[model samples]
Target: MDRFDQLRILTAIVEGGSLSEAARKLNITPSAVSKQLSQLEDRLGVRLFNRTTRKLSLTDEGGVFYERARAILADLAEAEESLASQSGQPRGRLVVDAPVAFGRYCVAPVLGEFLRANPEVHLDLRLNDRLIDPIEEGVDLVIRIGQMKDSALIGRRLSKSRRLVVASPDYLKKKGRPKTPEDLKAHACLLHSLRRPQSEWQFMKEGGGVESLSLAGAFESVDIEVIRVLAIDGLGLAQLPVWLVARDLESGALEEVLSGHLSPDPDIFTLYPSARHLSPKVRSFVDFLVERFGGERAWWATKL
Candidate 1:
């Protein structure tokens, strides 16, 4: 097998785990894939994979090769694109990933405006609560909430919104508002499994700093919208980022509980794959997000 083809197979195997799955993705048969892997290992003089029934794992040396190979492939792809004229307006399939609630209320609107501005550009926006791996999944950009830790990726902060502890008036009336962090144990605390910092339901203790309080709620949901609905129905207290509860708070569907507690505002960042120089498509899209949501009163900011 050709070295380049071998590298491709290696990447596919790393991502897809099973040889059969990798072959399916690469449009080859399982036996062909095994043959290629064996050839590549012999040529490179290293054990590339430790394969088992459940999955496949790379040898340490194999990981080093995969990283270098991936970079080389990216360079070749860039060269191919560079051969094509980049002088025209940015236009292509820009696959984006973002949190569901943020995508619906924030990214969707921005994307709509972006599409209108750049008629040539098309979007495949996948909105879910899970943290998506852009490189493996072939996503162009991702809008995320919280800190950026992965050194492999690049991130740009778009906005910040404070977290809040809120419940429906009926819920507060029934359960009584928590005056202290200790009181939270007595009430039904609806959790947003996606929110990292506030996942434990933090509170401002009387002295200083913060305290984390455990919770039991009538319902647990991964969907922010469903959590909002449950909170609106007086199911339990929900500690949500202000953006999710602002409209309800304004309309009196939700009431504040233990107001003085929430931690620092949760920062929102538009994360993209690390690159030396970003293409106009990714660059322009991230800039648009900053312009729209970077201001103090940006749309996603918490009002309550």
Candidate 2:
């Protein structure tokens, strides 16, 4: 039994959630995967997994072993990557995750150039709005916008996007424009359910102080795009990222409100699991994004 090979198989099974799925990922039959797991357990003299009809879960000892195994595998990969990096070309599969709209509009457009530049690398991009655990999901990188609450992950700020209170010209005409952040209380606001405190809006006061308002909205949705559409249709005012609503603002489909008192811009970050030796693929990709987005004058700033 190759101990390293068994470790790889064990991690694969844990990550893939089942023996069959691990087999598919490893390009082997389920029986072969099962045989390896059984052999590994026999050698160790301990049960590694608790199997049910629907799923397989790690035993207590297996859980402890898996963590150590993962670290060993990561160290081995890093050693191999260090050798590969000497050739000055990134290779292997890179799994990345980003929000849907940003991934579609900003990230996707630049991927062609990235792929063209690095012919040896293959990218697997997953677009999701939900926050994902990069380590658990086997993701190499995640592009996230807004405040990051998780301190466990390492991050690099790629760009910044301000939240703008905006509404359609028609909506503001009928509802009347708010002259101050305080006046927003009387107007119908469109809220993003995913945003923290859903109804509270934050802004910077003229006196270098921060103020927050607990607002009420006639419309709300888990999707920011939904609120954007509703706001565009004269439904209510919506505060959205400037990057997400830049085109609309430029086209006069939406007009900025209380721009003077808008909240501090949220940063765009590429997050990865905290590690001492960063993989070349992740490092190169992050550098590419920072340059593509513009280190200081990000593309989104042009719209503003």
Candidate 3:
């Protein structure tokens, strides 16, 4: 096997966590993926991974190999870029990942403009809320809404978002609007148990002190859209991301409450593998996003 191909195969296996997934990514059969890996290990004189029926785990040597392989690949890319600096246009596949609702409602419009502007660039946009490893998945950029937990990658802040406590006029009329954090518990909350329903709901007061509260509801959903529709139909209250409910708040379909005890601030960011010798495609995409979505577009701030 070619040395670089061997490294790439290993990277894919590590990222995909399944032989089938890696094989599909490489555009080959599972048998081919296995054979190539075995041959690669024999040539390297070390076992790279611990394989079982369920999943694959990298050995200590394999971890070291991953770091070296990435360095080598990055160097090769830089060398090629240096050589082709003047000759090549930004012509290649640019893969981006984003949350489903935000990607459709917000990112799609901006990216549509980008595709129109760059005729040579091909686009692949994947929308899912689950965090996927960009390097492992071969994604160039990930437009994520929260802060980075794994500080290994690079992050560019694109926008700030907030969680708002909102309910329909009918619901508030019947259940009564909450004036403080403690009051939320008395009302039925249409919760999203997907992210943080069982735990983690805090409010930041105007002077910066924080108060926490938890509410159980009759309706709980993993789907943001479901929660939105439910809340609009007056199914209790919902602590929703402002981006998801901006227009509703603007049109007064939903009314905001507890302004003094606002939820913790959330920001949107674009994450990539590394800044050093970053691909021109990655740089261009991040710049484009910041130009479009970057700035203080807090969806919670009602229009005057």
Candidate 4:
């Protein structure tokens, strides 16, 4: 394999934390990845990694080599990006990630327009609710909701959304609508399993303080969509994002309650690695998304 190719493989192996994961990320067979790594180490005449049956750790030499290799790769990427900018077109693979529900309902619907506009750019979109490190995963951009905690990533605010307490018309008819946050305790409140075992729901008070409720229910799910579906089926009350249940609320399938006691609003953001010269692919996509859904332009937010 070429030296640059070997560098990429080594970087992927270190970042992915395993040969198999690196192979998956590179879209190559694990055996080939192992073979290439072995050849690269043999040619260098030094052990680069300490390997066990289940773990791989870099040796001192490997660490130094990896750092230098990463710098070279970054320089190469910057050069390409500079050239692409001069060409005034984005032409490369763009990897993006977003939360499952938001990706499905909000982001995925708008992807066709982006691809049609930039025919030379290949898009790879991955959807999951789990928080992932975009730098480690080699993702070009990530759409995230809620508070962003990583100062290393450069984030641009796209829009804002809040969790709304809602229930199906039939559910409210049967259980009576909650007059306040305190009334939520007497009803079946769908809880997220991923939250603390004693799930707490906080709401804004009438006078500008916060009221927190410890809630339990017969049903709990890790998936927000599942909870939304249950709430739509008249099963229980659910606290869901405005973007997720806007249509249900409009169609009279779900009704919002305790509007005065809504939860804190969380902003949507697009995050990427801080770079000196941003690639056209990343910049174009971020701008496209902002134009389409940023600020007051979000369809779900507008429905309210």
Candidate 5:
């Protein structure tokens, strides 16, 4: 057995928390993963994991080994990056995770240009609304909107997006415009299920305080795009990221409401694992996104 390869497999299992998950990430069969673990344990004469029906936990010995193994792997990665940078070309498979709507409307549109610029780089883009753990998933980078929860990862602020309460002109005409946040209770509000307190909306007060209101809706959806469409069809009021509705606002399909009293702007961020040496591929990709988005005055803002 190659000890180095077995060490990598062992760390993958620990990070993934199950044989099946590790196998999926490594692109190997679960049986193969199990066999490698068994061999490694036999050679070391020490059990690495305490396995239960639902999950796997590290043994005391495993914890010690895992820390050292991770350090060794990080060092190896840094050495590899140093050599790759010397060549001055970004290559290899780069895995990126991004939110669904933003990836579809913004990031995905610019990918072809990135591909053309770096012919040797292979891109693996995964678009999902769920928050992903980059280190656990072996993702090279992730484009995230809103406040970041993971401090262990390094984040580059790409842009800022305002969260605005909006409604179609036809809807406002039919339902009548709400002059205050309290009036939303009487209006048909479209709720985004992914947001916390889905029925409650938050805003900044003119006197410099935060205001929150519980709202009722005729329509609700986990998908932001669906809510935007529902609002456009004159169904209800919807609060959405400016980037998503910038074009709609420009086309006069949607109009901002309570413009000066909406929540604080949420930032767009590109996150990656904190590493000793950043890979050229990750570096190049992040720089390209920053330049494309134009930092504070993003392309989305330009549309508005």
Candidate 6:
């Protein structure tokens, strides 16, 4: 195989975590992947992976090689993308990821306009709540809510939103509105399973201190949409992003409670692997997101 092909195979194996998976991703047979890896290793006089019946792990030397190989491949890809972008049209397969609910309700809806505007670009959008490494997953961009934790990626703030306690009018009427942060404990509070320590809720105190309370209820879900639905069904009160419940609040189907006490949600962000020399396809998409959701134009942010 050529040097670039070897590099691609090696990186794919590491990212895919197995020869078979790498084969699937590369559209090659597992045996071919194995042979290529073996040839590549023999040519280098180094063992690249420590293999076991159930898994594969890179050796220290393999890890070092993998990092350099990744950089070389990235630089090559960027070089090609830079040249192609000089033609002034963004044309390529652009892969993006986002949280399920937000991707469905927010990101997916805007994609049609973007695709129509850039007809040469192919879009592959993946929606999952799991945190994915963009470089490993080959994702061009990711839309994320909550805190920006990954220091490796570059993040552009799309908008800022606050988490607000909301319940159906019927629920509030039956459970009675919670007058204080502590009072939430007495109400049936729908919780998000993904939100750590599911029962612990934080609120901003009126005088600037923070109130942390452990609140529980009948319903809890990993999906924010499910939690929103449960709250609307009067199953329990839910602390949800303002964007998620903007329509409900506007239609009077849900009432916001303790708005003064709810802490701000982490800023919405569109994250990418790098800021420098970004491919036109990625840059255009990021710019599109900013235009759609960034300051003043963010309808969701305005709802609060």
Model 4: lowest-lDDT 10 consecutive positions: 295-304
In candidate 3, which residue pairs get closer than 3 Å at backbone N, Cα or C atoms, i.e. clash? none
For model 1, what is the alpha-carbon lDDT of residue 11? 88
Q: Write the per-residue lDDT of candidate 3 for residues 18-100, one digit (tens) a residue.
A: 77899999898999889989999999999999887876899999999988987897678667655544554554667899998
Q: What are the lDDT figures for the candidates, one per model?
A: 0.78, 0.87, 0.80, 0.87, 0.86, 0.86
Q: On residues 1-304, what C-alpha lDDT tens digit does candidate 5 reach at each position? A: 4877788898899888889998998899999999999998898899999998886999999999899988888778657667888897897778999999999988888899999999978899999999877888879999988896758889888877778899999999988988888888999999999988799888887888888898877888999999989989989999898888989988999999877576867788889989625778988999999888846665875534
- lDDT, candidate 2, at 216: 89
RMSD of 6: 5.9
RMSD to the native, candidate 5?
6.2
List the lowest-lDDT window of 10 residues for candidate 1: 80-89
Worst 10 residues of 3 by lDDT: 295-304
Put down candidate 1 lDDT per residue, 4-31, tens digits, no spaces. Answer: 8888998898888879899998999999
* TM-score attained by model 3: 0.69
Error of 6 at 228 (Å): 1.1
C-alpha lDDT of residue 265 in model 5 = 71
Deviation (Å) of 144 in candidate 3: 1.0
Candidate 5 residue pairs that clash: none
lDDT of 2 by residue, 92-117 (tens): 77889999878987888779989898
Question: Between which residue pairs do clashes occur in model 1?
Answer: 204-261
Question: What lDDT is obtained when candidate 6 is compared to the true structure?
Answer: 0.86
Q: Model 5, which residues run further than 4 Å from truth?
A: 1-82, 301-304
Error of 5 at 61 (Å): 27
| CA lDDT for candidate 3 | 0.80
Order of quality (lDDT): 4, 2, 5, 6, 3, 1
- Predicted candidate 4 versus true structure: per-residue lDDT over 134-217, tens digit per residue: 888889898988787858889999888678999999999999999988898899999877555537888877688777789878
